[model samples]
Target: MTAPIFPLSAVVGMDDLRLALVLNAVSPAIGGVLVRGEKGTAKSTAVRALAAVLPAVEVVSGCRFSCDPADIDPDCPDGPHDFAGPRESRPARLVELPVGASEDRLVGALDIERALAEGVKAYEPGLLAAAHRGLLYVDEVNLLGDHLVDLLLDAAALGMSYVEREGVSIRHRSRFLLVGTMNPEEGELRPQLLDRFGLTVEVAAPREVDARAEVVRRRLSFDADPTSFAAGFSAAESELASRILTARELLAQVALPDAVLRQIASVCASFEVDGLRADIVIARTAVAHTAWEGRSVVDGDDVRMAARLALPHRRRRNPFDAPGLDEEQLDNALDDHSNDDDPHDDGPGGAPAPQDSPAPADSSSPTDSGSAPERPMPAPGESFAAPTDTFRTRRLEVPGVGSGAAGRRSRAKTDVGRVTGSSRPTGKAGRLHLVSTMIAAAPQQKARGRTSAGLILRRQDLRLARREGRESNLVLFVVDASGSMAARSRMGAVKGAVLSLLLDAYQRRDKVGLVTFRGDSAELALPPTSSVDTAAARLTVLRTGGRTPLAAGLLRAREVLRVERLRDPRRRALMVVVTDGRATRRGGGDLEDAYRTAALLAAEGTAAVVVDCESGPVRLGLAGKLAMALGGPAVRLEELAADTLAASVRTFTGAA
Candidate 1:
């Protein structure tokens, strides 16, 4: 493998993101940080860099689970008694969950040979087992299959997986830090899964020209000499690792005062955030911030810093709402609660601050004393102060779309059909057919047929049938290879998602096509071909930069379908458009014309699914409108994974 490049010290401009990583490093209980950003936003680079700086954890030698021999609990099967000698130790592991991994490969399965040969049930370990006490990173997490995601969440929450398959009843501890990265353009992760994340930070491409240039320069240098480049940053990497270790040690002593608790609650209330997630995350993050700063006590500044990372994704009343704790409103609330002589006050250190003393400007104030100040007391009637705003805007209900019930029903139906077909074999069974056996036996009997021995089919003669469904699916991927997409890092994510989908299609023996539109033209890079490798190779070479010519791309895709339709009507055809919905050109005109053209093409017998790849606060624009016009689904790009593609294919074709 290539040596890891891009040390953690090289990351710049994303202080909030870095803080989230630091917090998670200090306390894994704080949960994983969700970094939402466009494509070129250094999200993966930062993550890899952080991984390099992480302290190497000691794990059991020869154990795929990376079990801590010293920390082994009663549930551990391979206890000290089972080992021949003292267990060995090794460095921490960073395991990547590839998109195409199977269920058996992920959660483990029965040892088939052991079961069949010796009639002994033996358990085999999987990726989860291998990732124990390490980092289990999943890129494009939102697009992961719902089943796989559920399994991951269950394992992460319970810290174990119980396997009760093939007469084996095995429960193994499989605890690991779940680090997931996604580009929001593909699709959104389910809310239940999203809640599991402790901190969320939105990453954007380098805004300054100098930063972008520097990124390119560094990347090129590393590519030219991976070993030397990594060696150059060794000192910086060591320093980061040391800092993280210090933070982890300091996390336990970081104290949260009642004042900070009140601030956290007030901020959540001000934002009208639903549930207790915001409050909980804010508190944990605050503690982590204090620990990171080498402080023994959490202060107002710690709470303030935590708010930025914890509050954004938690206040989900409006999914599209801008993130952060509403700094202006939060500052005002703090000012209002800063009064002295309040009986309810408990500022930093638990005890009441002197009523006559001025408030500290920073968390580290009273430096000469070398100790945190006493918690302040709340004034009379101040403890029960009502919020200025009782209610903010309710969560936006996208018209005509039922929130949970309808969606669940649709998804359930889709899953049922997909599972049934996926489980069935496509070719002939190995044994003799039942009908053939009956016919062969009939010929051996006399004309009377009943005079002979009663007809009996032996187990050796029994044959199981296989169900074969329509083989090919015409999948046309309409990619928005526009400049804006390239700027936000959406292009890389889109490419990844497309590659994942193509891999799925290839496995299913489906045909796929690639059509990318940018600048003044749309190009059909690859026709509908069963060779997914060829299509994927062409896709990887696709660079994003130009105006969006969505109309032309759709028209070309439609024409390709027109030809394919003549060959087979049973074969499913789908047009997947990946874009941020910003259809514009270099001539300084709105993309309204292109949008209309796309809509018209989509209406012409093409089953369409639009993936909004845009990130940040930008409006989704014409994508949603066009999806509606096409009478198809509009999903965020981050949500577009292998399962999503399969579900879309089934939905559009009404196929089993």
Candidate 2:
């Protein structure tokens, strides 16, 4: 028997999340809600409980596709239903889409043999069909394959699934309430996917002792005896459900006034979100909010409430950014939107905005609050400097292919992505190349005296599809914070470069570690982990000073990678060293020691990059020499930018 779900009414805190869920339920036209929070935050619990408060759906009895009795879908696979057939009422289902789900499992598939041989179309319904007219929940949504996510978003946007495979085509209504829950620390979803979500909210565990205690109390009680625990909250659940039903009925009658319409436009414009989707979502959510409040019209308050839920994901620029709107920023946008129109959208004929300002920070955390502290003067080997404005760095990928976690860098052998070719199964292949297997078996079939039933397939004839996809690497950053370069701008630029790389790692699903060498010693500032946010935090407060220990840094990086490889042998490592180059003499670590260490790394075939932080017209090209030893590329600071990268980035056989 399935365990009873914890009641939505029993959830202790998360007012924003609860409200967002209710609003989406009230108006699925709001698109869908993406809930982002840390683990143990009840994100999943709240989503599952949503089914309890949802009104039961009535469908044509015996219809496999869950077709509505009154509005039967003509295109439904199980169609041609009798209008006079018995009807059945059932609670809305909550179908789950697993992270590892394949395209065939999502949009349905065809029986290949029947379609190819018998010239018959046999369609097997997938999760999209199962979720029709119900709720579809995806857990660990960020970890889901990019292609699967695209398919999901496409179906959700179109409100239908068109599955055509092996000459068999099937189409059906797939409208549902898409509720996805993700822990930001695991990884980030693509920007394209983020924008598709109608509303986004960030939740954290309740800070209040009493609220936390209540959460534990209720959870324990439910675990002890789910039946009795759920029964106790039955009345409250029903009342909430009834309210939702009433809200749904009243939603069509709610008025969205011109003032509110303009307000929605103004808020989206002020936030400067890309595309018109945000505006539309805000408008829809505003109407839902009005109904939830038992009100007739969307007022200014309702508009703000809608923006609060709808604008977060739209404005996000990076993975580490906390997913929510700053109350002050939102108010300022709404209060001054009349004149605040795009800070850059001005001048006669919409003249180009001024281009002289230093670029916005790529390293700074958007969510960090409180004023920074004053930095004390550096002693022998340490200095404090704010990060320089980060730029769009060049793509620093590990050369060749690898078998690792799915990512956007370095070629990988994966199940997803386009089929590159076919290869015989080495051990257990990723995906089977049906056509290739048939081709390999065709000639042998006649030799084996095949009958008319079908071509006999032998175990040795199996062919697995070879696919080339990108895999995330373990990015180990070796930063030089020695006294040789301690100026704020110099160190800041170097710090900014590291910060920029960290952002890339976060987006590419790479685990990262930081190693800083100064004052005759190298220290592991941060260990390799999926949480890039933590690495960013450590970088923001990083202090630099002391003699440069270039050799020590390389040695430490090798050690870190060695340990990481043991834990996860499949994941590859890419070492990124940030420095002006050349080990300091009259004493720091020996330049020869550094070179030898670099050579060792190169011998190991470790993909590496040497970011030459050297500034000014006059230079020794010491960093280039170091890059040569590492057998990677030597990219200068100016050359690291997206615009200048292609022209100036040089591949170093051994040059730093």
Candidate 2, residues 426-502, lDDT tens digits: the string is 98747777667777877886789976756577888888877777788899999888877777788877777777888
Return the TM-score for candidate 1, rounded to 2 decimals. Answer: 0.58
Task: Return the TM-score for each candidate structure.
Answer: 0.58, 0.87
lDDT of each: 0.63, 0.80
Regions of candidate 2 where Cα sits further than 4 Å from its true position: 60-64, 69-88, 112-120, 164-168, 320-322, 332-383, 424-431, 435-461, 585-589, 643-656
Displacement of residue 294 (Cα, Å) in model 2 is 2.2
Q: lDDT tens digits, residues 264-377, model 1? A: 786676665678877888898888888888888887788778877777676543222223445676675555555544637666788744333232222111111112222334
TM-score of 2: 0.87
Clashes of 1: 27
- What's the C-alpha lDDT at position 294 in model 2? 99
